[model samples]
Target: MFTNYHEAIEWIHSRLAFGVKPGLERMKWLMNRLGNPEQSIKAVHVAGTNGKGSTIAFTRSVLQEAGYSVGTFTSPFILTFNERISVNGAPIEDEEWLSLVNEIKPFVDELDQTELGAATEFEIITACAFAYFAHVHQVDFVLLETGLGGRLDSTNIAVPILTAITSIGHDHMAILGDTLEQIAAEKAGIIKEGIPMITAVHQPEALAVIQNTAKEKNAECISLHDTCSFDEQQPTETGERFTLRTSKRQYPQLETGLIGTHQRQNASLAVLLIEWLEQEGYISVTEEQIYEGIRQAVWAGRFEKVKDHPPVYLDGAHNEEGIDRLIETVQAHFFSKKVHICFSALKDKPYKKMIQKLEAVSSSIHFVSFDFPRAESAEKLYVCSHLDAKSYDDDPRTVLEFIQKKSDDPSAVILVTGSLYFISDIRNRMIG
Candidate 1:
């Protein structure tokens, strides 16, 4: 087994490959060579442009509350790599992660030798999660979230009991597709034959595409809007208290640890999925456990409050829809306070539209570039945002300093947003 976290992560990162390699030939080969660990357990596959993580969080929590040992695998870790693999709602320990990586490295290497090439960063991570859940933790169920568009994503390997698509939006246009209908088609690829597919409320065009795809695949499709509704009241210092009402169940006074109105919809979808699972006899969780799970569950780096004094808010609003939600939440909660913003985004993102949204809410904007190859230059961001603001160095710390100086008002809120990578960087700095 690997001796340390650094070695394990480095070994995985050493085999990074870019771009889409459509078809599951490579993933199927790799998993088979590793004894097909993914098949040993049941899974719930989630895909979407937005809110997939939150849906996963809710699904996992509900299963865990049902007294089943659940394993959750999601991408783009906010603070630590260990966050990608969790069992029973706790991140896998560093020692366990290293050991798991060591166990899976040989199979990954063998795949490389046979001309499949080493798995992508996301592919390797997905493999690790499956092996950990199936072989190590021996989980009763595993919740998997797609890394990107689902049609060709590495995580699409599983034949899940239920497939879910959260709210669809226009992000990753270059890699997925340019139009909403095309993107919806790609996201809808997770619908396997006869598998019950659950979806959040989607645009008519997107919904039509998804419905057609599910019909073509012979998958039973469940729409969240048709099954569930929510009532979000004003936010308090503790957080937002919302009521989740489904056709068969009602969770009144449901308070989420997560912020924003969008989360209310996410929670409703989670409840609906759990209800569906229970009906199918896949799992059985009590109403009390459901309430507990919603109250205690936490998904970091999405509308998370990092500081109280001089109020700092961190959200990974990397796309137009996400930015809109961030703006709405900020306006509702901190409308009187001037907003100081720190922003960055991947080159492939709709940076121009994202910038426009931020410009509408931001009192001052500071741009910074992350170390990733996909990150856009700070100068480009500043120009595209069309804000006459002073530029800071590419360094995240330097940008944070600028925000600190500008946000002198105790009531003023400093919002660190625009990209998940940027939030990851800030999270690293804060902990260090």
Candidate 2:
């Protein structure tokens, strides 16, 4: 058994060699061995190509504001692994993490001895989240965000009270399928029989897929546009404020720490989910509580400004859609400011297209590579980008220094974008 947090993390990472196996069979067995912890806790299962994390953050904050004990499980840790699982905004303590890992290690070993096969790294982490929520934290509601495509993601095993799809787009296309319809079908797999679903997908093909899936499962699917429409988004000193017009309500000047127009849609979805919960008599939360929750919710690494002087910001725009949103927000807010970009991306991403979008707006672009196995090196990206005058550095910190040095004007803005893994490393070095 692992005796400490470091050992636990080491053991978990050791299973990475097994890679991703997209199926719920192993997870089902693990949960059963752990007394079906997932069935014991109330949960809101969330999935989508983007905005799932922000939506979960908004819902979790609102629930907390309503005096409900909330547990959250998310992925691609922007800061630390502990942030991936939290209760009331505080991450799992080291002692709690070690204790839980020790308790579950034996069960995992027993699974290894059988024909069912050992759990993947994500599955083990997911099992730990279930055990923590159901047995340790005993939360009133748990926000479970799928680690990958909803159909076979590790977190899809939860028996949630409701499910939400933030937005459908092209991401993980290889695993989820190449076409929009195919990806939408994979995402729609989270809809459970008789459960309610909410989605922000407006794309016709994607919406039709989700509708059909929910219909087949006898789930009540509610599109955000059918219930509410967002408008009047204006960036503020802290974040942004927007208005939501629902069928039965008008939420004006809703504020949130998460920026970008897409955030308004996400926050609106959270509002709709809460109202649906109230209608079903599952949870009672006041409108005022929700307003405060959306305002107070802090989703780091999504266009987050971690520094003021010289104006350094970090965003997780790993995919094309995310990059588009990031670009729109940057243009809307920082157009007057001289923008210098420090970015990196995974080798698998359409970096050429993303870099082109950034280059159109930035005064200069600097690419930096982190330690992620699939990360595209800055040197290779520089030659491939064909940016005749842009800078390249293997070390992210040096890239940051270069951007700061180049942008010396008072209105200069130093921005960081690219893979979430790269952003995680940059955030740790710059802020931690």
In TM-score terms, which candidate is top? 2
Candidate 1 lDDT tens digits, 353-413: 8888888888888888989978988888877867776464577787668656855577578
Model 1's TM-score against the true structure? 0.94
Model 2 bad stretches (over 4 Å): none
lDDT, candidates in the order shown: 0.82, 0.87
What's the true lDDT of residue 273 in model 1? 84
Provide TM-scores for the models. 0.94, 0.97
| Local lDDT at 275 for model 2 | 88
- The candidate that wins on lDDT is 2
